[model samples]
Target chain A: MNTTSWLNPLAALVLSPLLPGIINRTKAFFAGRRGQPLLQGYYDIAKLLHKGAVYSRTTSWIFRAGPVVGLAAVLMALVLLPLGGSAAPLNFTGDIILLAYLLGLMRFFTVIAALDTGSAFEGMGASREVQFSVLTEPALLLSLAAMGKAGQIGSGSRIEHLDNFLSLSGIYSNLSASVWMRNGTILLLVAGALLIVLLAESPRIPVDDPNTHLELTMIHEVMVLDHGGPDFAMILYGAALKLWVFSALLAGVLIPVRSAYWWLDAGAVIGGIFLLAVVIGVIESSMARLRLLRVPQLLTGAGVLSILAFALILWR
Target chain B: MTGLTGSDVQGHLAVAVSPLRSVVLISGILLVLIALLAVMRSRLLAGRKVELSGTWDCGYARPTARMQYTASSFAQPLTNMFGVLLQTHRSLERPEGFFPTQAGLHTETGDIFRRNVYRPIFQSVERLLLWLHWLQQGRVQIYILYIAVTMLILLIWNL
Candidate 1:
């Protein structure tokens, strides 16, 4: 039993909320203002938990179930992902596909909850979220596939082990110093695509401004406008975890720092995650959100990058 | 033949499969966590009285739903960018004079292909059918004359 593999999810649970706090702090520093405490998200979640939930008369159980199912689905996905160099605690050959679709299931529930409110703003947010996610999902999966091809060139030919094509470990399992030197372009393109996917999926600046209060321009925020109290806490925590998962995936790809010492590798992966949050914070501080029409263009550009990466890997 | 991600077996048909024991363990932990949160929330809310009130309007007494942005208006920028393709049809009742009553606007984003493509084809077909209405005229005399002409042509051909 690979007992140490459990550290991935435990670390993810304990440290995920710190990510948004760091991003907020970085943004505040750039703006020359004292930010909220680094534990502000944790405080907010605690406060929200103590409050009473207010449900709309128009909503049913599905509205209440949205946060529950979304958080659960994301947790399920976390078990499939390998945050460190080792395999996920629940790793399987095709766990990668399960991870991708589990996220889609989460989005599905969120959209359904938005429509349940029957509010114009929530509906609009739902429409935009689904449409943008349609583009981002392909970019994400294709980029992962391209990166997985890097792992295929281990001790043997990839053609021999074709059945293991969908394993998430295939993205990083066989990363050697020589592989990166030989196929650096493919790695670069895949990283670019994954970066776009991370930003779009996590409601980062270029795709969405999570701090925006203008309902007309909101995407993920407006959808949850009506959810209050404990339900809202669940949603907030779920968002942080979602951000953590994407950040972890991107960091694992960018920083392929594997070691025989499991603790050292886990420490590096965690450090890489925090570094990614700082990079995201700098990016948000630097750029404005894209115009709504321009969003599809950016997503399509990511898709093009993924395709290029895939083609490069296939050629070799 | 192997599946897209390949099969777990050498010759059998099962796809790439793994029993997610970790997921089962995680799910149990998560369920317990959720239950704890629910209990904590209930404990906090127990016997706590709350009141519902109208939304604060920031000193505006005439607070109304109309003040909020409508669905179409909220998505105006996106719809406008795709307006040529979406073919959004809007009917506006512009406010006439000062303080005009009954001023309103309606926007319909119907299918572009149905409105622009099918409508013209359907209208032309209806026009052609109207023109062909003369063939089934309800006059016996004209019908007899048409039959006579047909009989004469056949008789002449036979000769």
Candidate 2:
């Protein structure tokens, strides 16, 4: 590991909550209203942290465990990801699978916690969350695998084993502007699939509205309705971090700025992440959420995109 | 196996199991503890006004355990997706007239392998084994005659 490998994680911990703020501000600009401050996400978490929590009578230790586990899992995932042109803090062979399953662990805890509440709304939300994730996870893994293969091809090293390509840092560090120039089509397809995965995995406007009020219509939001105070703050912060993690992965692909200067690469990746947030905000402002039944089709479309990208890579 | 060092295999195995022993696991526990402390601090800030009440059930007056989501209901979405393979049998009886009858829906998921494969094989095996039942007779004289016939055959062979 490099001396400054820890800088990326530090940046993520400090700047992740800013993503929701930026996204909300962009949405407000589109709506022609004076929006909340750019630091509104931070303010909300702080306010929640200062208040008392209310636990449901039906809930148990699992409910309390959800937010903590989710936060920790996302934190772990944040480390596994390589931001900008820098390698991740922790990387080994097959770390990509670990990254994917870390997110899975977060979701599993969230789902079981929701189920523990015994509320019909939470159960419904949990079921929907699981159903959608079924499609998103495959797209996520396949896209990463395709990108790894692409990176392997681009590097053109004769001595290194193929297993080295399976790590996030290995693949991402190898990727540069030239790689994209050579394999633009496959990367484009993978990028599109990953963007869809990001939208679906995070509670964005198209998949599940973060600002939704009706519990019956909610998916991710409904699962955490019973939590309050610091617990809710952990969840909110965890969500922002989750969004950051996905954005980092997508940004790495979208902007393969492998400059000689470390600062330039890092700055470009961070800027790319913020740009993605703005784009997502604009998408939220312009588009409406899909009907509940049609969400599976959208997710499956992402899966198909990933499979096509992988197949194209294999063909070459 | 011939050239690779033990450290190399250990490294590979370590990578495989690293997710479980990650620093995040320890940090996750610490995070939970911190959250607990924060909750306690918040409680102190609130001056003990955190009220305990029943869950909101859309003003249904009194909510019972039956109104809650069951395990089957929780997995309904996934089950619906794999319905063809599961072949879950559902029986629904709707109330014929308003305020007059009972209505119920029952769903049963049986083990398909036992139904289609194991029972038939076990039944055929039982049938094939029934022919061996004729070896035992009720009388002691019949058993003695069999022993004597075996002895006579052995004596003639010796001669």
Candidate 3:
């Protein structure tokens, strides 16, 4: 458990930037173009950190606190998450709920900061972000609940108990009924929902275009328009950390190889992370940014699918 | 004790009826007074005859309501921009060329909260709970009829 706990944050920090890089590389490979270095994001963050930050005259203290709080929240959630089926350092009842709420808190502050700029473009982005999250939240929780229930895990249990592959396999094997069948179905459903959520939340392609300079069509990027220097670095790192944590969680649920061997589990987790990034890159490279009006339909479809998962669990 | 109980029931009934009876009586008297005053004022005005003359059109004989700006026209541009989210429906009819027989336009926008948020959720829930739809149809009417029947039963028992 301690080995897993130590490895989780270390892995999150090391692999966070690489995930985006890998996605871009995958997309580039598909297009038959030379891809950027895997460490390109690291270089970008270093450049941003060295540069001086420009403060917006229209902004208040919240703009300053937004990145700090955002980074802190994601780090805290990573601490709560188990890497390769190991319990996190801080495990408590309802910790997963706390993790989700902490992420929500970060988003709440970030959105407020966006609005504080008094930019109509930022305000529009914030409005759409909040509106979409309202629908996304239920799907997220419902899917998690379905997975937990299918595994015969109690809702109030700490996430730490499910950290590594060994424990997951132990729990999976010891169940009186067939847990893997239900777990596999729930995993697929959750993975699908989380895939969409990752795209939306991370401001990836289809839901948002990170590379786009136009603020009007931007989601996450537009919200951070006024941020610079260390603040911008923090936002970038925080987003990467968030993507890493969610991907790790999805990997834990889907991957079956869990033993006392930390190296194997870590490799599986990293491989899962890479696979997720490739999928994201493929999605971004292939799909055009959805019409703003149609984005809600995509989110609603995710919500409907998650609800069906919940209903299936209840019915069974 | 029995005699006192009978008087108490009568007293309670009076307590309920007295305020309503007084309110009706006072309003009836006020209505009559208002009618009488109106009749007296008209008669007094009729007795005094005065004649005055001025330009009926206030020196602008070409004035028309068509020349005035309307509130809807002022808000047309903004409403058009957000038409999708606002669910604004518009219909316009115009005659070709310079001379037009009739030209009219109408616009109606749905409630923002209902169209964007509430209706979608409601539809989702309805789809999830299709069996419960019958229970909600004419629900308010059924509730009112149920209340009326209960009141009638109470009234008969009291009588």
Candidate 4:
């Protein structure tokens, strides 16, 4: 109803691709090569929209439904998110669980879609996706839940964990440097855990190699290999949107850009998202993906960090 | 039901369950469906054709399922990470030299708990049954000797 609520989807549509562009540019800088234009994702999506899709002979409606369901789920998730430091278009006492499961819903459809193709590679990727997400999901929710606890900065009677009341606005609405200072260790740990979740959840390096063409090593890419034209485009845009959600969450926490005027805070939050993109690019450039076997250890370590963060908050 | 306490404010911190806007979700789904229909309609209007073919494989004259990595091979690293419990069995036949006859690899990653726990229990039960078979001799003399021994023990006790 309000201008800020209207801005959530508006910003998502126009600005989601920019984060990936920033990341690509940052990676290009580290590699000493000029990357594609920042608008490449937009161009790819447009091209995909114009082209005809190719469905395999063995495929069914499930494959076709994958992108549609996925994009829809992510769209719903965007509604719950308090992007650009504004209250979500949709918010409630416990909206964080809904947001997390919305993404989970996206993943569910994706894996089923991949399975529908009857491709061994897609099945393998689906398995890996599920395995890695098992750890990342807990880390993500727990860290966000920890931030929810931090939201009680000036409140009486604290609720804890995702099972309690991890609201989108509840976490980001009142973030400030003072909040960070009071629970600096807690915030720092949660952020560290969240950074890992962001990387893993978005299929960034260390959990998956987004740039790799080899099927054996693919996780997210291989699952959608059969999709072409508009279908593929939907997947690409959906992924960009998913990345945007994770970035918003991570940036919202790390940037704590609070201003009386809504637009200024929104601008600062957008800037923070781009900055997070650069950080991701730097990380990709600086490290090769972990050995596939060791990925679980890293994810489990993230889980441990979140648990430690949770323990610290409970002790307080 | 639990709550957080603060200097100036008083309220529950985390909501027990996340409240979502079903209307927003329904609208989002509707939009996605419309977009998909539009895509389908455009494809029909444009009459663009699709060519079906095998995925491009490395230029082998003939591509077989064996040439591509199996799911197990693709996930070998992760499986090996938990080799302690997974206990994957591998069988391979390597070519001896440049002019090879045949080479093959088979891998089986079985349920560790079933193998380590259930199999052992069943095996021990089998062994116990085998040991218990000594008492089931079918001869009549064995049965009579058992009864005589019982009667002599009873007579000695009575004296």
The most accurate candidate by TM-score is: 2
DockQ values for all predictions? Answer: 0.11, 0.34, 0.01, 0.14
Best by DockQ: 2
Local distance difference test, candidate 2: 0.85
| Ranking of all candidate structures by their lDDT, best first | 2, 4, 1, 3
- Report the C-alpha lDDT of model 4 over A46-75, residue by residue, as the tens digit: 887788766776678787788878887887
Give model 3's share of reference contacts.
Answer: 0.00
Worst 10 residues of 4 chain A by lDDT: A154-163
Q: Which candidate, 1 or 3, has the higher TM-score?
A: 1
Comparison by lDDT, 2 against 4, better one: 2
Error of 2 at A194 (Å): 1.1
- Residue A79 deviation, candidate 2, in Å? 1.6
Misplaced by over 4 Å in model 4 are A153-164, B1-46, B55-159
> Which residue pairs come into collision in candidate 2?
none
Kindly list the per-residue Cα lDDT of model 4 for residues B14-56, writing each as its tens digit: 2221233454555566577647755764564376766455543
lDDT of 3 by residue, B1-159 (tens): 555687789877875575456435433543454355345333433534323222122245553445422445434444554577777888888776888778888888769998878999999998989976665667788978878999999999999
Q: How would you class the docking of model 3?
A: incorrect
- The TM-score measured for candidate 2 stands at 0.86
Question: Which regions of candidate 2 are displaced past 4 Å?
Answer: A158-163, B1-49, B113-159
Residue A97 of candidate 1: its Cα lDDT? 68
